[model samples]
Each structure stands twice: as structure tokens, then as C-alpha cells.
Target: MPTFTTRKNKIVLTDYNYRRDIENRLFMAELSILEVDVLQEIINGSLKTTLTTLADNLEIAPSKLRPILDKLAKSGLFQIQGDGVLVDKEMRKYYEAHIIKFDDDFRPDMEYLQGLLSKAPIHALPSWYAIPRSSDNIFNSIIEKFLFTPKIYERYLQDLVFDNPIISSIAKQVFAAPDYKISASALIEKFGLTREQFEEYMLFLEFSLVCCLRYVKTNDVWEEVVTPFHEWHEFLLFVQNTHPVAIQDVTPITAVYEKEFGFLNELNAFVKKLLKKGVSFTNAPKDLLEVALLLEIAKQEKQKIVASVYTEDWLKKTRADQAIILYRQSLNRLIANEQFTSFSEKDLREVEKSLKNFAHGKWVYFEDYIKGCLAAVGSVLPTSLVNRGKRWKYSTPNYNEDEREFIKLITCEYLMQAGMVATGYHQDKLCLCLTPFGRLSLG
Candidate 1:
């Protein structure tokens, strides 16, 4: 069992055991290639060897081998005494078999996905493979790394770690325990996350299938709390072990779709109910509107988008000016879609009256236009992450015209971060478009 305790401002590591099969509790510590080579030397024990002789056999300095031995020893594999590396008797058997699990040969089986998808119901397909394992379907290379071992290693930050750092950090802390248990308030306050934000992150985790609910006593009452999904830890470990890679490429960590995994499930439900009712973005719940652009990006079949003139600059403008920028983009897209035969300046005179409220932050109208972009997946009732300043309270984004563009700009940025749209500068314009999965969502 692994344990963690803070000692003099440093996290102390102890008893790091990989309990994939809780009963067996394999002492499977992550090791470097060199470390594995060193362990192999000791385990082979083919000839009587000292550090100097072993170093000669491996063609490396004895000094270099010392640290590798230390790391493995600290990881509970061996001990060093009187300049001789001592190995535990039982380890001779275990380490030899365990050695392959850490080698560079691990690859997620392409057939794993095929088997999983085949087992899934059409209604629950999103749950099985909403995110791709890799860019190419012929090989399951992408699915291999995207699993649990090394998400931070991937080029695209689609996994939870990059999508929402705070949430990912919380998940890490939750797992860094003998068992997946942690104090709730201490976690929130430790990271300076508002209660509402923590709750939002919890929902994101729940959707990812990384957490399940348990109860802990709080203020004399038992309360439901979030903890690591024990079942998943074992499964993820099994998946990675069977397809272990020594290390993944260095990928810069950035935020990506935190809510996206859950969004798919939620959107599926929302669409079923939404079609029966007349809910435009104006009256659409916050969660629905929050994810409104996801469908739009899906329709475009692009991962990123260039906002061009539709950026924060529009938010700082006067209400009428903000309307002009947003309304123009809407008009252009509508005209491109053949919604209008030939719109021009003369048409704007009449269109402006209808778009006046939309430009002034009648967000639902914008969402209504985006409806055609979605594949009718479910979405949850819209909600807010902004601290409402009261217990269980709700506040609309923009109650005044000046607040309209502010909300819109923020939404656009969020849509990009959530992988709904990847916003970037393309040819000196703000580009907005669908991502890979975003296009996949369309299918």
C-alpha cells in the first residue's frame, strides 16, 4: 500500500505498490529503461558479479548503476549493503515476469476497441468511444496512450488533465492515497477552488467514469463525496500493463475538453427532450447554451476556428456596435447556409431589428441558430460556474446590455478550451472550428 504524508513542506513517498489485482498487490513501480536493464543484470545472476564487474558487462560506469539500484531499492525491490546489491529471494521470480510490463513494447490492441464497440448498444456508443484512441483507425495506437497511463504525454490535450488542470489536480490528489479517500473541504480550500467550481469539476469527473460516489461524515451528517473509481483504476492498470510502453513523447500540457466526456452523455439526453419543446438559446438552460457551440463546431467538421473580428474587442464596444459584429457573423453564416437568397446592406436594415436583442446578449437566439449544427446528442440543463454569491443561487450571465458581449466573449473562449472549438490565429484571423472528436460527434 502506498502512503503519502507532508513532511517539512515535501510530500513523502512510502510503500509504492501497484495494486492492479488488489490481492496480488504487485510491486510494480514505474522504472526507466536503464533501471530495467540494471534490474535484469541483478536478476539474471548468471555469474558472480560485483558492481564493477556488472558495470563492465553492461558497458556503463559503476557510479551510474548505483542510482538505478537506489531507485529500485527505494521502490521496495532490493537493498544495497557493503557495495554489493542484494535482491530479495521472492523478487527473483516476480521481477523477471514484471520486467516486461515496463518495457517499450506496450501498445493498446486495435482489437480492444473493436471488441468494446461491438459490445456497446447504439444508444450507449458514446460511453464506449466518444474519444478516439489515435488519429488513424487502422491501428489502435491512439487508444493505447489515451487510456490511463500517460495522457499528459499525448500531442493533443484531449484528456481530462489538459482540459481542466484544476480538476485533474484534484483527481491526482484523490488517487494519491492508500485508498481513494480525501477530505472534501480541505481539497477545495487547498486549491482555492470555490465550492461551485469544485462541484462542476466533480460532475466532469463523474462523466469521465473516473470517480464514483461514497459517503463521509460532514458536520454531523453523512454526505455523498467523490472518490477514485476503484473499478476503473484496476481496469485502466490492466489495460496499460497488457500494452505497456516505456515512455511517451514529450507533449506540452495545455487545457482541453474537461466537460466534453460528460457533455456527450448529457447532450444525448437533452436532444431527446429538447425536440419536443421550443427552447431557443434565449430560453435555453445555461448548460445547454454553454455547450451550444459544440454542435456548431461539429457541423463545421473542424477542430479549431478563427473568430477574426468576433473577439473581446466586440465585448468592449457599445451595445449597438457589439450587435453589428455578432450579427454580421451570424448573417454571413446564415447566408452561406442558403438561409437567405442574397443578403446585403438593404437587408441588414430589416435584419437589425430582429437581431437587436440577440446582439444585446439574447444568447438563446444565437444558440437557436446553432441547433442545426448538433447531432441531437443529450445536454444537461444549463448551469453556471460563476460563484452565485448566495447558497444554491442562480444568476443569468447578462442582465444589462454592457454585460452581453462580456458573456459572449467568455463563452467563446470556453468553447475553445473545452475542445468544442479550437480558437487560433489563422492567416491573421480568429479561427473557430471543430476538432477531430468534434467532427466525430457529428457522425
Candidate 2:
């Protein structure tokens, strides 16, 4: 069992015996091999198939398959009609909205996706934990690091030290003792370091997104205390118990997102004002709309579009001026999309840095500049064929479809949850636009 102090609720990591609640256990319940194959057959058959056909496909007799089908129906995974089985309607609709049909070529990949989903962790917060204040925590800092600098975070995860030996040693000590709050003076004495040296080390730990400092009143003096958050379950427990903003309310990501870009509140207000008129989308899917918005935000950052341009007075400009801005932005959007789609998982920071360089409206050819930047940043991509000037040229591009999906997942879905973007519809398609809170956060 993990140890934690009653007063500070600080965690002491000895063994990871984090147990899931009954709800989560049931939610992640593993299916038997027969059950999985049966579901696959149903999905492959467009969510419905006659009893004889399903049994034939499985190389099992109708008599043997009847029991499985009956079991699935009882579990709400299937509905048995007179002669056929149909997947639950709600489940069918969800799969239809999210996936293409499992043709022969992609059926195996579809199975792989199913396996991945079954193993995916289900995250939930208890009702008492308010989500709005969630950003003001160390977990949020770690999440931001993952979002903005995934490659670096991946490297850090390979070694829990995060390349800083001092902090790692300190964290180890904190973890070594359970239910005891180690004081600042004691750590300084134990490590045989000066006060300034200890403070600097603590600062590095906090800044590097590892452990953090809290205050605990010991005897007559208020002393500094440190604790380890070695696992996600422990962090979730901390968030539930901790009220970080006991006095002033602030979220860490809000400040981090606004770094080097400044217009979040203004952009948020503009979006709200537009939504007051009521908007609807006819043909846009939620995911597609989010991607569209991310692209638009990137373009806006690259062009350094003033808040004024997004206002109604933009229509007051001359046709030529309007046409020029429209044409350039439209053309830039295509260029940006191409560059984004071409990005490797390791090159996300490269893309983000390139956009930030243009935040002052300093635009350049997308491919040429990215190739140069990739080279400068020491990307592992082969650079021999980079400057041939041919369109759609990639220099030894290593494509990982999973990485691309993860990037899109965090930027699109997680961004909305962070209050950086708002969703609606425009011109009969789904639209996502930045709120003022997200304005300066794009690049």
C-alpha cells in the first residue's frame, strides 16, 4: 500500500498497488476470444448478419454459435431478431460516425484498433473535483509539456531523472520515506549543500515539471516540504484532495499558452459575440471541425492577423485589399495543411517553432523554411534531397500513423477541453474558432 501523511496528504511511493474502482474495472472488462471474433464478424458484415452466415463465417455450427449470440444479446452488445443478430443501434451509430467500413484490406487494422481501445485507460474525476480549476496543478504542467514538447517528454520518461541528477536524487529520498514530510533544512543538511544551492535545486525540480514545494508548519516555524508524485493514480488522488488556489485563482496552462502570444481574452469574447446569433453545421464532423480550427489558428498566427481584421470593419476595406488578404490566407492555409500533414512526431516542435517565428507577420515559403529548420534543429530525417525545390518532397520521412493521430487527438479534443477553442458551424460546415482565452495560445 502507498503511504501518505494525514495532514499534508503527501504520497510516499513504495509499491504501486493502485486499484481501480468497480465502475472502471467493469468498464475495462476484457472480452473472451470468441466474443471478440463474433463482434469483428458483426462489424465486418456491416453490423448485422443472419445466424447461418455468422456461424458459417466462424467455421462453427449454428448450434454452437447460438449460445455466444444469446450471451452477447444479454450483455447489450447485440440484438437478436428472428433469424439474425444486429449490433446495438447506439454502438453501431458511434462506430459508423468514427470509422470507415472494415473492408478486407483494413479489417486487420480494425481489429488492432479494437485491441488498442480495450487496453486504453479510462480517466474520470469524482463529482466533487471541479474540472475548471484542474489546470492549476503539477499534472497540468506535465500535460502541457507532453502536448507542446512530446519528444522531449518521451526522452525524460526513459529515465525518471529528467537529465538532472540532483533533482532525481532528491525525489528518490522523498519516495524512500512514507508518510513523513521531509523539511527544507533537513534536505539541505542531508545533501550537505548551502541554502542557495538547495533552493536552486528545488527550483529546477519544480521548473522541470517533477516535484513541487509546499509549506507545512513544523513547531514554531513554517518549513518547506517536498513530496514525490511517481504515478498518475497518485496525482489524481492529489488533485482530488488538494485545493491549489486557496487564495488567488489561476491555472498554469492559461499562462503557459499565452506565453509569447497575448490575445486570449479578446479572442474568447469575439467568439462568444458571434455565437449569440446562433450557428449550425450541416455536414461537418466534430473531429474535422477541430482540425480545421487548428489550421486556421496556425494560419492566423503565421499571418499575424490583428484583432481588428476579425472585426466587422474588415468588410469596410476595399475589394482589392480584401481580395489580396483572402487570397494569401487561403493559399497559406493549403500550404500549412500540407506541412502539418507531412510532420513527423519528432518534428512537431519544429513546426511550432516555425509558426512562432512568423507571429510578427514574417512569412516565408512553408516547405523551404521547414526543411531548413528541420536541418538546423538536427532532425533525424534525411536531408540530402531537401532543397530540390520539387513540390511535396519529403526527405526520408518516417510516418507513424499513431503519432499523427495522437497529435490530432490532443490538439483538437484536448484544446477544446482547455477552453482554448469553441465549436459551432459556419457556411454549412462545422467550425471551430478561438475564444479570446485561446487567441494568444495558438502557436
Query: What are the TM-scores, per candidate, against the unseen true structure?
Result: 0.23, 0.25
Evaluate model 2: give its TM-score.
0.25
Full-model lDDT for every candidate: 0.40, 0.41
The lDDT, on a scale of 0 to 1, for candidate 1 is 0.40
1-443: candidate 2 lDDT, tens digit per residue: 22221212112111122222122222212335565466567755756678999988899999988887776565455688978777776665444322232222222121222232232222221111122434554333334442123244334433343344555667666645444236666787888877666665654454333454444434534345665322222422332333111112222112323321122333344333433432243333344333334424211333232232244454344433432343233323434554345444344443333333333322123222222232212225532212233211223323254444433333333443444434333233332334444445544
Candidate 2 accuracy as lDDT: 0.41
Per-residue CA lDDT of model 1 for 1-443, tens digit only, reads: 11212211111111122132121212232344566677777777743346777788889998897777676676444667757766677756655544543334422122222332332243343323343433454223323433323222222123333244676677677766444567656677889976556655554454343453334434644344455443334433433333212112212212233333333334334444443443444444455443434333111113322222223332344533322333335434334434333333343332222222222221122333222121111121122212223211111122233223322333344333333333333233332334443343222
Clashing pairs in 2: 264-436, 264-437, 265-436, 267-435, 267-436, 268-435, 268-436
- Candidate 1: where are CA atoms >4 Å away? 1-33, 44-48, 79-83, 108-443
Any runs in candidate 2 off by more than 4 Å, and if so which? 1-30, 93-144, 150-443
By how many angstroms RMSD does model 1 differ from the true structure?
Answer: 22.5
How much does each candidate deviate from the true structure in C-alpha RMSD?
22.5, 26.3
Task: List, in order, the clash count of every candidate structure.
Answer: 38, 7
Relative to the true structure, candidate 2 has a C-alpha RMSD (angstroms) of: 26.3
